[model samples]
Target: MPPTRPHPRLRYQILREQSPSWKTMGTIAGVIFLTTTPLIRPRGLVGRFPNLHCPSSKFSHCRTTANTATDAPPFQVSAAASSPSSAIDEEKEVTSSGNVGADDLLIVGPGVLGRLVAQKWREEHPGCQIHGQTVTADHHEELNEEGINPCLKGTKTTHKFPYVIFCAPPSRTSDYSADVRMAALNWNGEGSFLFTSSSAPYDCNNNGSCDEDTSVVPIGRNPRTDVLLKAEEVVLEFGGVVLRLAALYTSFMKVDAASLSVAILKKRLRNQILLGCDNHPLSRQEVMDLVTKSGKFSETFEAFTGTNDPLGKRLNNSKTREEIGWEPKYPSFAHFLESL
Candidate 1:
């Protein structure tokens, strides 16, 4: 045999060298071990060196992330005193596209519904403060375009802008209470908190005309209803406006409508007949006439839930009209469906 070659370990060392994260970590750990070796007392002398564990190279990234996280979040922050008024001042410059009201207005809600409502208000009063809230990220661009600043979820603090509309819907049926308390919070307790409860809150039967003063009966233990009631309770206690909208209909019905196309969505009337087919709650022709055409339709028709139950005949919105000057400028159910 030739002269004895070096061991395989020596050949491996000379054959190749490679570097990766683990390799770097190992090298650092070795360096630390070398530097601290002198400080390490013998187990016998120290009684036990179990207290001095190996320095782990794996912690490099953990240490780096920990240090970096100490920095602030990525958002503009102003002191409490300057935040609200500055925002208002900034809005005044940009929101001239519409007529604002004498009293500042703030609307709390999300989705296209919120945007359209803000636009509706702007169209009505260009000077009113049209503050909007968006629960989703993708919606921010559209909201900004509408001159409606977005509120980060669970991060909005009330500024008392004279009017705060609780336009937020309850969480999906899976978990209605998930967002129920949000209504209670945005009220801010300083101004009029407009709680948009549902016409469903009124138990409408076939026999009588439901009015605002009608005593409400507990229909069921539905969380959506409970939240609306809770929100209304909270808002009303503070002298805010409680508008129990009855199938919101106006010229711009597409923006904020319960049903988009009465023709296609007529299937929804399946349950309405259970109350009583005698009452037709269609809103298409009325919606069409108000937004597109006009002056051709005649008469206001009421949508009835078709129930003879004494507890179910209380779904009228006369109070909204009597209290506020706002009126439904569209068709009654019979007039709307007749067109369809």
Candidate 2:
């Protein structure tokens, strides 16, 4: 992601440089960005490439192994030098990567979004362990002072665990491969490597309606797809799940987002007329209540790229809702504003 060649040992270098002062809240944003960039790089990549370590588990292990992708990454060191105990434990749990006993999870870049997802998994699977990685001084401090580091807690199993999650966003300045390597180093496959990429990876169709299976060939010229495209390549080397995430809105998180909508509505009211989108003006509390009450509902909205842009149309989540068994709980935008 960086314009220049990456520093290979950047992770260790960063760990040593300001790891002591990495406790302030201000560092969360920076750490989230920094650690994420390495995830954008290719392994053994120089000149703007970085490296890190991943944990081994029953579900996944990223320490190293032979890869057959066009990227041509060398066989990872972990594959050749691991103990027999490092062999995958396939009888205990089911993994997204088709593995058994996914007892460990490596979560990269812990923050608002990462926290919600990781917290969700933790709640759903009480038997699993999750470790978070951060390189920002403030985040490092927060992690360290909080005793959240796995090594210190005696949580890391030397050989195997489960899966690893790459929740970092891809950016032009990041070293995608390197971040993944760091997550994979000293590692072993646990189960699968899950990458969270943006929907930008898809080409913007003339009608602006596309899904995961859509062809990306047309998006080559689009700059937004550049980072996610590259990152997807690196993650595919591990042969795991890759999720193209949509614009996210979560209750109990980013409460300010709801307030922002309220402010916009009030401003619009001053203009004498109001028309809200089907999903608009929804507040966190109202949405939560709906889920608590009915627990299921569905809706679709017309999403346009631009107001003057004629090449736009509907973008719905019906597919995801059906696949995940989740439906929209919030109904009326008016109710959203009322609850707010």
Q: What TM value does model 2 have?
A: 0.47
* Shift in Å, residue 338, candidate 1: 10
Instruction: Indicate the residue-level lDDT of 188 in model 2.
Output: 44
TM-score of each: 0.47, 0.47
Question: What is the TM-score (0 to 1) of candidate 1?
Answer: 0.47
Off by over 4 Å in 1: 1-102, 156-158, 172-191, 206-208, 219-224, 248-315, 333-340
Number of clashing pairs per prediction, in order: 17, 62
RMSD of each: 30.7, 18.3
- What lDDT, from 0 to 1, does candidate 2 have? 0.36
| lDDT by residue (tens digit), candidate 1, 237-321 | 4444444544332221322232221111111111010101112232222222232233332333222212111222323343333
